[model samples]
Target: MDNWEEVHEKWTSFQNLDPSLKKELDHLAGDKKKLEDAFYKELTFGTGGLRGVLGPGINRMNIYTVRKAVNGLAQYLKENTVNVYDRGVAISYDSRYMSQEFALETAKVLGAYGIRSYVFDELHPTPALSFAVRNLGTAAGVMITASHNPPEYNGFKVYNEDGGQITPAEASEIITFIQQTENELTVPYLERSELDNKELLNWIGEEIDNAYLEELAQISRLDDDGIKREKDLPIVFTPLHGTALELVTKGLRQLNFTNVDVVKEQAAPDPEFSTVDSPNPEEHQAFTMAIEEGKKSNADVLIGTDPDADRLGVAAKDDAGKYRVLTGNQLGSLLLDYILSHSDKAILTNGRLIKTIVTSELGRKIAAKYGVETIDTLTGFKFIGEKIRQFDATGETFVFGYEESYGYLISSFARDKDAVQAAILACEMAYYWNKQGKTLHDALHDLFEKHGFYLEGMSSLTLKGKEGSEKIAAIMESIRKEPLAEIAGLKVLEVEDYLSGERTFPENGSVEKIKLPNENVVKYKLDNDCWVCLRPSGTEPKIKCYFGVCSSSNQESVETLESLKTEMENVMNQV
Candidate 1:
């Protein structure tokens, strides 16, 4: 079948395998299925780069695998990038297990090629790495993180000179060079001593951090009149045992929020993520510790960030005095409304609000209220970053960009989703509303009252390992084969099959081309302006179903969302 056995033999017999890794390989001696799954193929490296379980196999995220990927990037940059050595790559890592090791190994691989790399001394946010690329005028950047994945998982993401994730075309070229790397263990790299002697590996920290924070301070300040509005407002933050503690705390303090508190349990970087079952901020479970801290301190608001701090989750006390976690869409809507209502007219002129296709329509309506046009990109924040670059070229202001996955971008300083900037601004907004005797919950209600209650949610089925991958493919294929006409009595007006790059309108029997890049996704524009979309996760082994509904009242939106979700489940179950 494949060369898995051949690959396995090479890995096991390698002379200089890490001793711990060798032991792990030895433990797999009598396990055929585990071996097959681990060595069936090299880890998939797409636009998102490499992500997989941590272990010794070629398909896992071990030192050799990391080296192989870095070597491929080295080869690609040497060929395609201008001033390859002079315009070095910026590298940063998160709090995941072996993340620092992977970050150092990345520098060493590039060092072997005589390519310079500026490495952060400690763990940094993904967006900071993106900012460092442009700040240092580097040819590319690398961030070693799995985002919100489980403890045993780790990943590497690539960025272009524009400080955005590598575009699809660029990814295709890098994948070609990566495939050219035949032997993982044989890939050459400079040792730490060699790296130091060559002066190719450089350490970077505080200066870049200050630069990033200073840029954020320029925009995160909402009230400039030196007005006193609960400046000591109690705020609770938790990094969820990730990398956000230093930057986020400094950011809040910079905003003059003196009473900010950190959940002591999640204040330190934890590889095992001992505090929460899942490290993702989007989940309510991740807020347990932060909410507990909020209750003890009578905090006005709570903010929780994922491991890498690219995503932010928020909660605020409602009239009932209990904290309620805000959905990504709800928080996004609040941010949009606050920015538009407070910003000067000239800055708002020709402003653009960019959102992913799956984001709630409520933000669109909010932007329209301010006369700002809302544009939809694909699901990834990179697409939004690309739009920011495009708009800059055309002399339009990049107002704000966000997605439904708890990631938001305020300014163009950091091209990727920036939770640091968002946290500062969100805390300021919360404190400002608090002075008026209202919580963020009240601000959200004011938005809902004006722009109809928009409820959006996602459900994913986790299918792990190779079998899960196959099942995800089969499910998508089945949906394409037999398109749906209705879901729970709701009529489907149009079906968008992104794989085919075509949109079919069932009512008119017509088709149109979708302008976005090709992805394996399907969407339905149903009657009553409701919509549903399904796509296999690019970075995780899951198929996600996104549902959205807008109604005159909160109760109506909730009921319709439940109906839509149940009907979609029934439809997929049939498939």
Candidate 2:
């Protein structure tokens, strides 16, 4: 068990491995480094669930690992969920390699434990899966997708009954059970025939889609007059070869937006994502085809969604009439402003805006204009979802929520971020601004003029395999052990170490508690209204740094952010 040879032998002994996988095992025999990397450790299960490259071995996202994870989830349900058989799991997958197979694997594993499962007949967006969990009154949900990752990657995301990603405590307990019951090569998975015979497997399609779409439509605030006037507003949308093609387009049509154009080349669900370098909508590169179509169609705005369709990206015409992609922060700010402008004053006063700590402060400034308070969570939408759940008793209205990575939620109907919701919002907001002789870019400039300038940027450094993991650990440890006093010549006013749940103000030598859960994140607040945060990405083999700055002008904000980024890179490199 201590060596790669032992792990390889055990895997080779598995009689039921697919023929292709067996060939793969045999093919890997000569590559000791590959074998060691494949078997050195199992994929870690955390708040994001399991994510890794697609291949054989416990460290990957093959059937055996999926089964083991599902079995652990089944055990967790049996022990915790009341009426477990009645309140089962709703399962869906995206158009990634082996995603459908992994979804089936999950259902089969749950079926083996006498738990019923509603599996999607085909691929669906991650937000739809979250909606299905609540719509079906299920105990939990499972989505087989790697979000916007590359083709080689896949993941399994777990959701609680409320349709949000499982909290840290639930992940911890499920991970414990997975470690105890996981014999990856021997994990049990029921046959489709047996599961069907037991009535434990059900295929869900249009009924759930209809319900989800209905819920999504409820979040729309476009009046008929506005829709009628702006129905012909030129708009271009792309699904980026993932699951949002139907929902995003259909949602816009339902809102009477007749001039919507779909990017024909990237419309279908292609597992390899052959159209773009990466399926991430956050990157302008993903919109290469969309932007081309936009110009040809004289589109006023362009929108695109990631593979799983949980994130959205938007492009708008700048002052010079050139199409420019909006950053996640800018989009979120525009959407917030639009939603609030359309709301009644009383509702705006009572509403609360939720955003990740790393998101731009521009959202806070916009929300403050309406007398709405902004709440900060850790860098995940689930924490924002948790806040929405808490609002039932707190009497605070959930206005809008977004993270800096293009994940957004406009309503509580779906717990996770909904690109379908964002698409309609962005288009309608564009149309609304267009009606007033302005564009999103114009609106952003107006905001900057009124509320001062704020900018946010992020970068990630990739390191692969075991060595990379060690390097990430060393970097974090070094930063924690010896904190920085300044960055980019700006004095560090405070250091918030989320891992220790402490916020220390260097000026006053006072330490206060951070009321959120402990996480391996370090944030430095500068003397100026700027800050930087560092954390390892939960789903990828990379470390991410977030920078935010505010000043009287855009030039100052941009220059300061670049300076901070350079200093951050220098510090990370030394670490």
Candidate 3:
């Protein structure tokens, strides 16, 4: 069906649509661009799951779309899962506008299909939901969060029975079911009272939180004594007005960290995320309040977790007494070093550091120094989680996994990035180093000095709506048509085209199949371990470019990173 036809069907035929959505439809009636933007295409049920701006229309994230997705999940589970009713599904949501409503709708839709749902009593972090799936022994899990996206956005993430994000194969099957549910309004759904009467809905609370925190405590390098030793370490944290406040604070307390501070203004769950332009911890704007709190408290370090608490951001005071936000690569590398350096290397015979292709090589280099191997997956943490599952079955140890987008996973138990776990370890690292009269800044500097300065940078071009998406597609195709031979004077020795499913060398023209699953990404490998990557964001309407370089001095790495980023942006713009 054409886009306008879908809009007309929703606008004229779907009478039972929510009043607010109906109002939005009326509001957009006069604007063809807005109408087309909202109806041009269905919001993709990607490998992770559904995510989009919350509004009216078939394409927006609303009850109809949520129900359709859930109903499809129900259908998929009914066919694939054994004893599906008894196995059940876990449901969770962060503190976003309509998050609870969407989660409730998910349970209702599943209930109509006779699928049991274990939902949280209140908002919780994404990691807890990942843990809940395994802890409850459910068939699957759904996390309703847009992660670090702007206020207008909300999302749904599906996790497998293994407690990790759904694999590509599983997602593909579920997506087929979703696409077959043509009209969103036709998806089977039950009311809340009906769900309760059917005994298909269960509410989860601190039991899940406690279990998740205990796992974090176990994987931590610190014991009670170590936590006590570092209890007096001054740290500031902000949840960016999302669902992380209670659990992260409780986790810190459980570890006996005494001097932890929460940024008062951003501590509560504010769906609007009113304080910041975008709630992404990767951006400096999100750290404004945390920085102020850090300065006033004379904090040794500052940490901020995005809404849903999957990704973490850290800042530490430099010599000028100003807080410098560490890039995801820098912090991830620091954490990787901290975890490996303080460990018993004898137990690491099968240990591996799993990271995404876009992640910094500093980790690979760091792992080499400690005699550990690093595995590079595609850009998503889901890929990292897949590696963990694979290694587990293969009798290998999953040491640590991270992405440069401020996501990290310490223990494989959760199967996704756990900001709470990373926060605990960051606090511990700060305390341990602080006792030796070093701040996190000093520790980071020490790493750079010991293992050459490694710098990384990311740039995003946001172009919303259908036209923007087409342009993004155009840019990606252009990059493929004319591959970069060099980045900032460094020769591009190899190209890893995930979409093409091949890794080719420029000099020899040798080709090898990429073992990782196909994704719409192309990476250029340069001499001196420098490289540039170009890919469209999976969850947002933006093109992302990542640049990484390693050098002996900070200036060299900084200069190289700037040059690489500048040159790549020029390439992208030309496209």
Candidate 4:
């Protein structure tokens, strides 16, 4: 078992498997590097569940790995529930390679365990899956999407009955089960028709779609005058060859936006995503075509979504008449300000805003102005979803939630982030601004002025393969061993070591407890309102360094951030 020959033997035992499965394995046969990469480890099922390159290997995403995950989940459900089949699981998929097949395979596996499953009839957005889980009173849910990754990648996101990603404690239990059931080849899967005949499989479609849309409509605060006055404001949208085209466009039209233009080339779901280099909406390149079309049509805004429509990206015309893509922080700030400013007075009485710890502080400032309380969670939309559920269970009002990574949620109906809702709101906000003789950029600048210049940036250091993994681990260890007393000419006031669950204030020589769960992250707070945080990405092979800086002037903030980024890079490289 030391060399790849043992691995090949283990792989060859599946020769009698499905043709597609065998073909994928055959393509990687006898290639040492490919074999090692595919078998180096099992695809991890953590708090975020599994994500990997889509192919045939134990370490890769394939039928066997998926079945193993489902088997573990099935066992967990059976042990936790009194009525296994009655507490069904909701399943949905996006427009990625073999996403439908994976979704079906998952459903079939759950059916073999005598678990009822409700699956979307066609490709749908991730948020819809989250919503369906809670709406149907299911025990769990699964979404088959990579969420802005390239076509070569696919992922499985697991959710609990509350419509939130599995918490760390729950994920630990599932991971233990998956590890105990090591022989994935022995996992059971019934035929699709067999499950259908047994009444264990349900296909959900427009009925749920309409219900979800109706709930979304309830959150719309657009007035008749505003809609009428700005109905003709030109806007361009691109789904980046994903699942949101029809739903987002339909939502826009339903809200009385008559001049919204869809990028025809990327309007349809294409697995290859031929038009863009990567399907991620965060990158400027993903919106190249849409921006061009917007310019040609003299549109006021250009918006794009990734394959699953959970995250949204927007570009607005600046005072210089040039289009500038707004970062996730900027977009969230604008949305928060707009929603709070325009919301009914009744909802604001007990309203609360939730954001991840890494998100910009500008959101908190805006929320303060409106008497809205803001809470910080760990860096994931799941944490936001968890907060929403907690509030609902306790009868507290949920107002808005967002992460720094282009994800936002407005309504509790969809527990996860909803780009469909964000798209509709963005358009309405644009309309509101248009009627005020201003643009989104102008509005953002005014907000920046009100709340001192709050700037944020993120840098990622990518390390691939097994060696790269070791290197990243070493870097984190080094940082922990040699603590920083100062960074970017500012004295480090405190260091929050999430892994140790302790916060140390050097100035006061005192320590405090952080109530959050333990994680492999560290944050340093400077004398000024600037901070730096470092953590390994949960789903990708990269170490992310996040920066937040505040100053009286925009130029000063930008310069300070650049200096901090340069210093951090230099320190990391030396390690």
Q: What is the C-alpha lDDT of each candidate?
A: 0.90, 0.90, 0.88, 0.88
Model 4 Cα lDDT, one tens digit per residue, 1-575: 23545655677786557678688778876688887887777778879789988887777888889999999889988887567688799999999998999899999999998899999999999988988987888999999998888788899989998888888878888888888885777788899889989999999989888878778776777766644443888999999989998788878877778888899999989999999998887888998999899989999999999999999999999999989999999999999999999887777888999998889999999999998999988888888888887886777789999998999998888888999999889988888898899999999999999998999998888888788788789888988998899999978998998999999998888999998888899999887799999888988888888999999999999999999899998877777
Candidate 2 lDDT tens digits, 310-332: 99999988988888999999999
Better of 2 and 3 by TM-score: 2
Clashes of each: 0, 0, 0, 0
Off by over 4 Å in 1: 221-223, 227-230
TM-score of candidate 3 relative to the true fold: 0.98
Q: Model 2, which residues run further than 4 Å from truth?
A: 227-230
Instruction: In candidate 4, list every pair of residues with a backbone clash.
Output: none
Displacement of residue 123 (Cα, Å) in model 2 is 0.7
The true-versus-predicted C-alpha distance at residue 323 of model 3, in Å, is 1.1
Candidate 1 least-lDDT 10 residues = 221-230
Clashes of 3: 0
Off by over 4 Å in 4: 1-7, 224-230
Better of 2 and 4 by lDDT: 2
Residue-level lDDT of model 3, residues 507-540, one tens digit each, is 9999999998899999988999888888899999
